[model samples]
Target: MKPQLLFSLLLASSLPAADAPVQIGSRRELFADSFLIESFSGTHLQLQTPRDEGVAFKFDQPWEGLFSGYATLVTLGDGRLRAYYRGKAVANKDGSEEELTCVAESADGRTWTKPELGIYEVIGTRKNNVVLMKAHTATHNFSPFRDQRPGVPEGERFKAFGGTMEGGGLTAWKSPDGLRWEKLAPEPVITKAMVPYKYMFDSQNVPFWSAAEGKYVAYYRVFEGGIRRIVRSESSDFRTWSAPVLMEYRHPSMQAPIEHLYTNQTHPYFRAPHLYVSIAARFMPGRRVLTDEQAAAIKVNPNYFKDTSDAIFMTTRPVEGTAHSGVYDRTFLEGFIRGGIGAQNWVSRTNYPALNVVPTGPHEMSVFVNQDYAQPTAHMRRYSLRTDGFASLHCSYAGGHAITKPVVFAGRELSLNFSTSAAGGVKVGFEDVDGKPVPGFGLEDCVMQIGNELDRKVAWKSGTDVSKLAGKPLRLRISMKDADVFSFQFMP
Candidate 1:
């Protein structure tokens, strides 16, 4: 389907309450949103933060110094990992002469090394790892992704967009092997003339070929009413785009406060391709934390210490056959990942996460973050999270239970990604839409789940098979005590 037509068919409001049962088929669903939830007795949705796994690599290279930022981690078809970021030694304008793009490579996502590409001469040396140089503002934020569109030619296997409003607008860039690059068109494809926002294209303007949408979707930056927000557009051929749409946020219960979102690192979750996860930078313009003594001790840039920043989590689903929701579900308004325990971490724009969260292991995924910004100690740090574990239906020791909305399934058994304390556990039961328990799948028949596992099949007193209940509209009650249910899906 065309992107414009897909976008036009989306619901005006993403979180509309309906009485009819929703069809989920066999796709995995996370508790990150309230779409499948009806009500809760004592449980709540908890936003999960990845565990810090220490430094992945540093910007200590000659070309990639303290000012190097806007990093992106891409996993290739052959399992090789590519890390790209800007390289600048000192603070300068967006399109400064010193600004250049560099790449680092890794077989496994944990260890990264910058290869001596010797592609472009920088700092009077040809042994550097520079990819592109002398590209004006485009180098400021060059974002790329591996295009997964069905018939996308091998020459266009990779795609990218980079530019600034001051430099005209976003220009299209493409590569065959992802090592060498070239512009798809000489002129900017998305310009100010197509949008109403005043300031746009300043941050990491991310674009990707969405498998669920079957079209190219671009989520970029824009300033409306002086607040740094996000705007989205779509294209079928990667050259022309649809009318700009300002993304709105919705919650199941309350309205969330609006803050400056510096960069919306929005992309489809690798496991659940239909759900888009955004580990965004929440910027507080003047929320200063460092004192003069602390700031000077760390040798942070004088201009950057005036404010602080951290990362936040948001999700956008392909609601009701629509490709892009054009709305984000703000389930938990708090920071998904907060600043660390040092004065250096409280500095301005220091905790901004990288563009994508790539898997480092079979059971582990990693989110790379730019840490210690504006200082000589600047580097990218790796944080680890369990697979499909972004948010969860959490319950404390006090114990609580939640019931899901009516949903029809197509599988034989249910499996979950969950964690629990030794003394606590989780249980699941099936019920009708009117709250009547199903035979052999009531609360009493559930076998308590104890310990942690990425995928554990739930069992009843009878067996783990639920194929008898397949194709029938029913509700699920998740009861827990000091446990977290990250995600659940039916298996055939």
Candidate 2:
């Protein structure tokens, strides 16, 4: 059997039966299927091909001189979808230079356009060209890095976390508009604590903003030769970060070089409260020598061996509601390699049985994956849920309270009916899973306001008012002095 097939089998054998009942609250029901093994058809997901396609702004020439390295997708303030990619232009046939930090944008996720003003530029000759972005005021040195995960917002700007070359230290950047970015002082937010270890760096830094804790949580890969591990950190105000905590999971063998990984945002899947996705890449030993023509095209280091293993592998996990503090109930998918030369030899032979855990409540989640390659490919997937048996509520509280039963929704629209028992004194609003009220993103904050009146039902639904929730996972909160929620349901 193919490695991919065997991997699936192993995963399947380890999982509970599909019909098994999962407990949520005092009720028991089959866990909703978060991932659809087959191609999904809807506004949320498109281009379900098996090929390894990188994220980029839609362009007229879809495949022309596109930078396909580690990439991140962000929805800008102007309602434009932007892709910040490790831009490397295709070199000329004569082995000339062409590579830089690139940026692209799309009104819709499907169509993309490269902006004239690229984010960062690399200068010098083809062989000696170096990255020309501002140095981290913290480190005061130039570094090679990629895979940037940007946070929602703080004040009027956004925060991003990524890794640097050599020591692989964690770095931070701030952007007012997601396009024009500025480096922050006191770089390397998190690093090895004065340890004797030689190799210490952060790979695939993904941040989750928590309004409940009023802090930021980051997950990344910690590399130790022959061993790739997952680590996490917490920060407040994006300045100082907590030390790294090693996760229990690791690859079976260290034969392959693991690069990076990511976690998918929490969203409703099937009918579950929260679904999380993650992807990672492991580069097996033995490299492929490229020809002069191919070498000139990509303009990569001639000495570096080409990646010969699978371009991507991913797994999914269901947050067991509020009962569990961390990840539980996991599932693995041995992704099929499509497109790119390195994908030819990739195979999955392990069997991953389905893993199921009882539902606890809605929890913060993220998705990470490696996207560095000769052709530099990346993968993204979308999931949806039905909003039945879910309700949205608005509340006013100085402390955090866990909604034992999170409101579930179908597609991405959240509709709720609420009322306040007081006069026109205070305004009621809704917040996301992080607790921050999203303005314009409707799901962030209350797009519609409710007047204070005892037993009054106010009907509200999210659409263009809160565009961010258009196709993303979300939660609701009410910040009114005397607000009470009566009913809530999501629409397809």
Q: Give the alpha carbon lDDT tens digit for every residue of 241-318 in model 1.
A: 987777878778788777899989999998888889999999999999999999999999998888999999999976
TM-score of each model, in listed order:
0.95, 0.47
**Clash totals for all models, in order?**
0, 60
Error of 1 at 159 (Å): 0.6
Q: What is candidate 2's lDDT per residue for 1-492, written digit by digit as tens? A: 432234345455665454332322211121122232111111111111232224322212222232223444554556455544443345222111332334555664444555555333334223221222333321221121222235544522666665543433666766555544566645566655522234444233456454333456665545544455455456765668765544333232233333432222222222332333233444444445455456555543343334344433332243232211233123222332322444312222101101111111232111212222333332222111112211113244331222212232333343444444444112233445454655644323334444532222223343323323443333444333334343333433
Q: Supply the TM-score for candidate 1.
A: 0.95
Q: After superposition, how far is residue 310 of candidate 2 from its true place, in Å?
A: 2.9
Question: Which portions of model 1 miss their true places by more than 4 Å?
Answer: 1-10, 13-17, 321-324
**lDDT winner among the candidates?**
1
Question: How does model 1 fare in lDDT?
Answer: 0.88
